[model samples]
Target: MTTYKRMVLASRPKGVVSPQNFRLEEVQAPALKDGEVLIRNHYLSLDPYMRMRMEDVKSYAAPQAIGETMIGGTVGEVVESKNPKYAVGDKVQGMLGWSEMGVSDGVMLRKLDTTHVPLSAYLGSVGMPGMTAWYGLTQIMQPKEGETIVVSAASGAVGSVVGQLAKLRGCRAVGIAGGKEKCDYVVNELGFDACVDYKAGNLVDDLARATPNGIDAVFENVGGTIFDECVARMNPFGRIALCGLIAGYDGEPMALNNVRNILTMRLTMRGFIVSEHMDLWPQGLKELGTLVATGKLKFRESVAQGLESAPEAFIGMLKGKNFGKQLVKLV
Candidate 1:
């Protein structure tokens, strides 16, 4: 039997991820059965959620076991198929690991048409990331016209979409990012009303000046220091959509000091996962798709070359090194 190369978790990570924590291994892929297809991975999305999976802790999602293939979503091409629903040369989105190729049951794989958009779109704005923003805004945060919205990690895969959606709905959008360059991108290119540089050392004061009336809705991505400030500044009856906490997911818990704000403001906070709200995905996708197709939506991706660079790309993403969606191109 012929085998393919894959990146697997060698051991659980402690603080920050290093290349030594992961290993490349060759594993034999079994023959496809009925309702199964062989896929050639084209692109792999590296998200902040993956970092949480690297640790040994209880979370909403299950932790990836040591010595198993690292869990991630992928956009790939079907090279062979035993499933009647799928044919050769079809593009798909599936729960495939970081590998050259693999056979999977079509249950988790959704057929994709690259003709309408780029093949990588399934791993980006036209797919999960887009759906995440849609659900977080419409279902979770519930922003009203003239309300102010604040989002952390504002230049990232999920946060960027959150900011633009707020702007589209006639609300003032404020973004919090790591540096001046990223802050500029969200404000100038993505049309955010204001942005704060978290590294500039004035997150709390900047947020104060940017949102004078107080934040009505917050799309939270970095859930440590930024969250503490956001909770402190929330308006009465404010809505907060808690997404991934990249800063805290890396193992350093930020000290919090906002008990008075939560109690006095009476904020309603909710945490959501994109997959849990899959029932509304069709509607969300259709809406976001129209925006992308009409050019009202814009996306940026930092793509790594091949499977050999997956580890480095994964590491860089935890440190917020890439711009927009971080992807690994296998072919």
Candidate 2:
């Protein structure tokens, strides 16, 4: 094929993201140069972090350039190669953005062993999201056995892994998700000790009843009222790992009314970007991959068929529409 379809940021969102913000275009494929590999992307990862990158505001990483291919993680098979490091038919994962086909110079691509773990899983449980959970829970929270830990957005890709890992570490894992079905999946399927449904309009009361011992550690994903309520129940010397703030992703104000709890309870809170800590990927991915391969770590995916469905799917995810890890199936 001489041309391929790709999506680019057409316009930045003023508040909430809309379909108009993205423009799909067909572009001519360029010839591969030396040390470059060509890949036909099989899956595209739609993550909350991509929303943060859309704004031209100060952040840990530079904003996604307007008119550039939308930023995303992808897993695909190499179809053509000019690089000695990557052979054709080798499966690889890379930051290839939102495109059906991408060319990599072998620098950003990593080969995957899909013998046990599915190819798409490398984008979720055994990939970036998994590493994010591992770093936040193991490195930041550092919960002790018998301690109670609560994770917001508890049914999401990152939060689900956090709660499961906490359970494995002998901590009581309580989840906070949006709906009854999600809450049930968190508790029954993922095996969290309890899951509080935030959409039930009883976040404050429900969270209190779930954590009667008070929370020893918090894996915070949705920051806003959920985070504030969690903070209010934190035990003394609690540790918080701030991963994402999906509640306020659309320029909404995130005001925490329980700031005093952090001081009085002596809570330790740390915000992290998994990409910033490349040194830990080997160790984190190794453990995560093993657990997933052995069925000790379970995960789910909400797949949006075809690339054209990306914009709507992404908007839905921002509004808590996805069940688990949101992904786009591309071929």
Best by TM-score: 2
What lDDT does model 2 reach?
0.94
lDDT (10s digit) by residue, model 2, range 19-122: 99999999877899999999989999999999999999999999999999999999999999999999999999999989999999999899999999999999
Error of 1 at 278 (Å): 0.9
Model 1, range 19-76, lDDT digits (tens) per residue? 9989998888788878889998999888888888888788887889888888888988
Cα lDDT, all candidates: 0.87, 0.94
Report per-prediction Cα RMSD to one decimal: 1.3, 0.7
Off by over 4 Å in 2: none
Q: Which residue pairs show collisions in model 2?
A: none
How does each model score on TM-score? 0.96, 0.99
Clashes of 1: 0
- Looking at model 1, which ten-residue stretch has the lowest summed lDDT? 253-262
